[model samples]
Target chain A: MPDPVGAVARLQQELTRLPGVGPKSAERIAHFLLSGDRKTAVALADALRDVVARVRPCRECFNLTEGELCPICSDSRRDAGSICVVETPRDIALFERAGSFRGLYHVLGGRLAPLDGVGPDQLTLAALAQRVRRGGVREVILATSPTLEGDGTALYASNLLDGTGVTITKLARGLPSGSSLELANPQMLVDAMDGRRTL
Target chain B: MPDPVGAVARLQQELTRLPGVGPKSAERIAHFLLSGDRKTAVALADALRDVVARVRPCRECFNLTEGELCPICSDSRRDAGSICVVETPRDIALFERAGSFRGLYHVLGGRLAPLDGVGPDQLTLAALAQRVRRGGVREVILATSPTLEGDGTALYASNLLDGTGVTITKLARGLPSGSSLELANPQMLVDAMDGRRTL
Candidate 1:
């Protein structure tokens, strides 16, 4: 049959490309957008564009930001002597929401997933090593997810910083296995932060 | 504490505004976008913008289209003598997907819901009535959803077309209650079409 509603069909297809959105959900969203006020549709489009245009990885920490450095990196009040490593910027946001971490963050962009072709070179591992070697950094916290890939990435980073004299710590096991920091409850996250163990 | 990853947090907030996207799903989508390729993000943004810029309701059928008239209204092969009335463009798509309806369509934009302040004025009933009176319309099918609002809208439209001399019919009752034509299985929809009843 002729796809007369081709524009709508295309919209649904594009929406389903996003994670967790299936064909049914995409269709529902397309209908909702078409039925809503024109301004709402326009605003969502603009937000999508703005996010891509204004946001970039922080040069130092890889967290998303509008400027050369992420806000956390530029903030003078944050502890300059400590860095918490994470897999993505969303993890940084989760930690920030709990209001417990006052140190700097280093986003690895992704964990070490050799199966997915992600290696130490693909991540910001060199920048992290350089930061550790530059001195005054008392600790490097491995706050990556507890997944196998996260554990592997942590081990790789720890090995690289073995003789650098900087203390290496990993977040505690209070967080359940296979759980993302992004999905962890605030209390559990706080417990994990408080009970961090030295590597 | 300060939201260090404010950009991601804001992006998630914006995503949750879309229909059927709850907070958890929204977060998942945001993380996906953050981790996804720039081209995918750009494509989604472009699609949203394109839909907003190009799609508008057809003047005659009220079906969404990129021009003054929808493809169904403009197509010469369609049976102009028969008009299938539906509550939304999504419903029109469902009917079209069946590939059996050679008739043109009229989208009511929504069903009658007094509690939601939706009335006959909010619908395309007047336009449909005008179309029915203008000429060669042998039949006007009330294919609105089977819900209370849908039945109310169908009844209201039937009353308006009372003296128009065109035959009035409704899709059969094989469709389950409190469900949408968009969600009906193809066989059930075909059965409803094959077993239509005249009023």
Candidate 2:
């Protein structure tokens, strides 16, 4: 419902479109923006605009980056031969927080989910094959979620890189079998990344 | 700590300033913004900036407004002789959503809280008294929260309007004694407004 005021209602509507924000939370957030620090609200708005306008997917790995490549891909010290593949840029942040995976990362943009019309062409499989074909990659670790879609994507990616000398691996079932990688705690992520096995 | 990338971390930091967003939720929101619907995030950012820039305090009643006065203050159909006093703009929205009130409102900006260093000087009490002294207002309803700060503000406002020939009323403690007017459900708010008692 539109709030008593048009702006409040509009704001509540905008917030409800977020990933996890519901109607009640949207109301609270809208009221807070209207009532709390104007500077804070302005800052958040500016940040929101800036992040979307400025941050782009890295050219090589497709992770969020202000430059041509993401920070991890640009860092010279990270193990260049080992590419830890994840489903999204946020997964990279999760890994970084866990203090695990010193190697580089490749973001698939998303996994295979035909129900949602997400297929092989919808992902970054071609880019993965190209990167592996370029050589020097000793191991390709699949850190996608352990869900059905994630497994299908991993199997598909493995078939694409089958001829390449790279040893393909998947994160151990250390994560709860079907839980999301994004929801894993830092310790759990650390353990999962450490115990990855050849696929 | 700032994330490895400047824009990602900046967005996360900005989100953390919101009322209920913690560090983890900030991270989640920031990442979701980057990866979710680009149009939705853009709209929210625009709304945030628009809300702060456009919604100003109503000139006569000190409630939030997109123009010179709030809807209630501008409407000719409302009961001009009854001004429901409130602690914030959100309370006015809450009451309006209840659809039980057809009177005007006077926002106090905030309730009196001495420990929080908020006093009469910090509120809109002077403007309220001036409004009452200008005459024609038959009932001045106090719809502040039911907390100590709310009661204290109600008492102070009552003292200010003691001899104005206006009947001042407080929303009966129809809400849970410790609940806030802004957080009250529409049904509860309707009941409270209906069961107001003479102060």
Candidate 3:
């Protein structure tokens, strides 16, 4: 209606695309940025740009990284033979925060939802299989969410890594029902990941 | 300490600066941005830059604007004789959403917080007085928040407009006590501003 009062409308439109920001939250943030020093907005913009430009998918695992490989993937001390497969990069962060996983990670980008048109080809299933097939992978833990889609993806991953002598596992049901790895509490995730069950 | 992962750490550091984003929230947002298409990040940064570059305070009322004057101040339909004073531009947004108070707004930038060393001179008090003194102003509505700082600022504004013949008013305490104007619901704010009492 009246061109929506300044850059606030534009800023709100931009901010609402973020993961959790709602219209009201976007409005509040836009107003906060507009009323304060220009530097804060500039800093936010620069950070977004920098992260987009510098952060690339880790080569070995699909976790986000500034380098060719993610920290967990590159660290020799970590057990590379135990790759924890997760649906998204944030899941890796959760596991890392849980501090129970000293293994590398394989980010699937998303779970396999056949009803939604996402299949094995859509995720990092190929890379995960190749990583396992290349030998030395003793265990492959599916840390995907506890949802139906997560279960389907885990089953697919299990099949893909079959006969490789790699023990296939899934995070224990200690995580509350109907929760993603990202939402699981650190202690619960630690318990689940540490006491994972063979699939 | 091994340099802390990758660009995620850097991005999280930047995101935590937003009003309500905590460290955990920042991490989630950072990973979300990095994993998405580049255009999303670019769009967010561009919007921030565009807002920073274009948005300026209305010269007449100090409300945010992409041009010389904000839309409310620029509109010919709004009442010009009545000026509503507020602590921030968001307050103006809240009032506008209430669909009431079709008048100009004077953003005080902040209230007088003596303990924090903020005095009358720190806000837009002098500019407000000048705007009112320039004449044709029938009423000056002091819509500053309901906190101590807000009360102090309102008291100070009332004294400054003394004998100026302009009826000074304060928003009726329809809002919850000890809360800022920004937190007030639209209906409550409308009732408060509509039932404002002359001080």
Say which candidate scores most in DockQ. Answer: 3
User: Candidate 1: where is the Cα deviation over 4 Å?
Assistant: A1-6, A174-199, B1-10, B174-199
Off by over 4 Å in 3: A1-3, A175-199, B1-6, B175-199
- The weakest ten consecutive residues by lDDT in model 1 chain B span B1-10
TM-score of 1: 0.83
Whichever of 2 and 3 has more DockQ, that candidate is: 3
DockQ of 2: 0.51
lDDT string, candidate 1, B1-199, tens digits: 1553555566677788888788778777766775756677777777887888788899899888988988888999899999999998888877877788899998998999989998888888888888998989999999988777888889999999999899999987678778998999987787778777899
Ranked candidates, highest DockQ first? 3, 2, 1
* Clash totals in order: 0, 0, 0
lDDT for each residue of candidate 2 in A127-159, tens digit (9 for 90 to 100): 989998998899999988878899899999998
Model 2 TM-score, all chains together = 0.85
lDDT of 1 by residue, A1-199 (tens): 2565666778888898988789878877887888857676676777677777777888888888878988899999999999999988778878987789999999998889888998899999999999889887999999988777888999999999999999999987678778798989887787789878899
lDDT of 2 at B2: 17
Docking class of 3: medium
Q: List the lowest-lDDT window of 10 residues for candidate 1 chain A.
A: A1-10
In candidate 1, list every pair of residues with a backbone clash. Answer: none
State the displacement of the C-alpha of residue B70, model 3, in Å, after optimal TM-score superposition. Answer: 1.3
